[model samples]
Target: MTSSLMRKGSRPLRLPLLIAALAFSGAAAHAEDEPGSLPRSFPVATPAVAALPAAPTLGADIAGLLEQARASNPGFAAQRAETAAARERTDSAGALPDPNFQVELMDFTNQMRGGGTTLVPGRVGETRYRVIQALPGWGKRDLQTRSAAAKAEQAAAGLDAAWLDLALTIKQAWLRYYAADREAALARESLALLGGLEEATLARYRQGLVPQQAVLRAQREITTQRIAQVGIGQRRRGAAAALNGILARSPDAPLAAPAEPAALPSALDLPALIARARAANPAITADERGIDAARLERERTFADRYPDYSVGVTNNRARGENQTWDVMFEVMIPLQQSARRAREREATQMLAAADARREATASRLAGELGSAWSTFTSAQETRRLIRGTLLPQAQATRDASRAAFETGRVDFDAVLEAERQLVDTRTSLLQAEIEARTALFEIEKLVGETP
Candidate 1:
């Protein structure tokens, strides 16, 4: 009778315990069905550490990048070094050849006769001292000096061009990094939103308020977003690697997310931009210097055909009574030498080549200016449109869909669609920003100054 009473008392507790165990089991099963469950052997990606330290936090501005390039970029440094070396050569032109000095003994008595030496003018054992100097061709040194100076100037301009190109490249890489970060963030947010929708839909289905099809659709979206996230993440990683490469770091080094580019200032008139480019652009200046150098070289080469004068003093002692000293000036007139003809021909060819190159460079820069100008204008318009209209519309649509879904008027599919639209719009805006930044870099590169 006591055992029967205990059994009746335990029935309520036993039923509740059984119900709780069943609920826990169902929750576990649902979690197992969820995507992104840690795999039995989920492979964690090891951090890439084979590369070097982070790039020095030189400001991300163009000027900072340019300065770094001048210091560390081998090509630019080589050009600057060349300029320095060329300028040093100009000192060679004005340098006079070493003056020669001579000393000799003169005898007034016949040494063969064993005569006594006399210390007097035109006497035996008299010592004579003299010096001599060589005169270079008239204006030859001046022309050579000018030519060397021009060459040095040309090299300096080339270095400037190198710096400008490097600055633009860094800016482009920075913009690319920003784009990658933006896209990756969007992908991550979409993935999280899809996962949340999957959980909500699963709950609704369990309550019998929504069909199993809704749960399946949410799962599909989660899978799709996960795939997109992976893809964007890979792209972001690649972009980071590229940024490291630009900073002269190993390509695998981890990089901090780059900042967005600053807003572009109001556009400059094309005419003004072109004028500034012509005056200050390194490529154009280099060509101009090259033309001047070529002219100087031509003049110097022509001067090479002229005669050079050498003045010297000579003393003769005959081992006898007779001795003499004479001062002489000699002119080495180079007759119609084959070398002169060759040099003239060479100079003519070089002058023609320089002229042609200058023209080509100018034409190329002009075309580039035009293209960059057009791109800047177009990107500005696109950026304005995105900021003013498209982004707002996408945001509004997404907000409306969220409200509808909360009120149970719209389905989970509508929410996913709205979310996808919002992500796309954001990505497009990022692209527009990148385009504008790239255009600005191009303008600065061509103009050699900020626009």
Candidate 2:
């Protein structure tokens, strides 16, 4: 009989990778065990579990990873560069059109018709020069500047959102890797424990207390578990590689299992979380910025409907006798009324679309926040029920059944059933824990905070 099942007692890691983003972010701790809540079971005399090194402080490790990723992640780097490039265009976008200077020379002077006097040229250098500067319609320049500034702000917000999103991605990958590692460790330990049980069963069979079928069952189960071990190993490797990719490391970069976060908060204030999400969510902020830009663009289009004025000085001269310096003015009329109106309509429509998109975005974020909160709450409860009740009861049942079988008081089938129940319950507990953590991470992403 396998005397005892190992209870997971690994210290939770404090993760501070999210600290720079929001003040509430901190390392979460796991829940305490209440002994009596465990099911009725006898303690089996089993060897102490193997010792594992204390996990590194989670906060420092997570923060360091984030820093490295921020500097090294190629996708994020590209987004940052794009934001900078957008900012660079602001000044150019708002600047006035360049003034023009022109000079012309005629190869030969021709007879000129004048109102009163006959014009004569002494030398062959017939020259004309003009310097022209355009003055845009009233408010056009200011509108252009506003539009450009808004665009820059949109890009800036987009970059901020991308940075937040990258943090979320890193968090998800880390959590997945951590969960996979834990699962693999549990699977290995379970296999070893199963070997002990198999030997105990074989000893009883040799003593003629149990049938050969019990030994065969144990062997068959071990074979099935070995297949599962292969799958678990593959999963662990895949998760590690995924995490490495996010950190901009080589695909085969080795990673130790990170410390798991403590249980999710039992009672999260959903309204408050939703408020935070509405206020701080990067996607929502970006959309709002986009709306501002779109509105400004509409204003710019309206400003474009008026005509522009060009004013400058012109000079025309003969070689020696006659020279004139005159002030010249020209007007650019808005002749293509239908085309201009169509553009204005397009801008107006785009502005409306942007506004609608913002509303839709807010609604979508709210929905996601609701969903994440629900999952977090549900997972939290599931883990509580499993850890505080199901796990203990199942362990107690397994211990009692194993002891009974050893004493020849219970059938071998009872022992097998109890063992399966315990294994299934333990596995369920692990999955529940991972769900809680994953849900919490999702909430953190939505609210832009983690604890």
For each candidate, C-alpha RMSD in Å? 11.2, 18.6
- Work out the TM-score per prediction: 0.73, 0.80
The digit string of per-residue lDDT tens for model 1 on 1-451 reads 4564356546434657778999998788767654755543566565687877667555344455546555676665676788789889888866778998876556656374467765554445555666789899999888978988898889888878877777777777667666777787887877777777778777778878678988888888778877877877787777666656665667776554555556687576888877888888988888889989999999988898899898988665544346578888989979878989899899989989998997887777778888988887887888788879988998898889877876788987787788888888888877876777787788888888732
Give the Cα lDDT of each candidate.
Answer: 0.76, 0.77
Cα deviation of 278 in candidate 2 (Å)?
1.6
Best by lDDT: 2
Model 2: per-residue Cα lDDT over 1-451, one tens digit each: 1223233575333346435435533212112223443322545455699999775442234565678788889998999998888888778876778999977654344434222322333334567778999888888887777777777788887877787778877777777777677777877877886788799899999899899998999888889888998988888788778767887788886565576555457778989988898898777777887888888888888877778899999788855558889798999988899998999999999989988888898788789878877887888788889889998999999899989988999987888788888878888888887777777777787886632
Give me the candidate number with maximum TM-score: 2
Candidate 2 all-Cα RMSD: 18.6
Whole-model alpha-carbon lDDT for candidate 1: 0.76
In model 1, the clashing pairs are 108-124, 109-321, 110-321
Candidate 2, pairs of clashing residues: 14-59, 16-59, 29-262, 39-392, 39-393
Q: Model 2, 103: alpha-carbon shift in Å?
A: 2.7
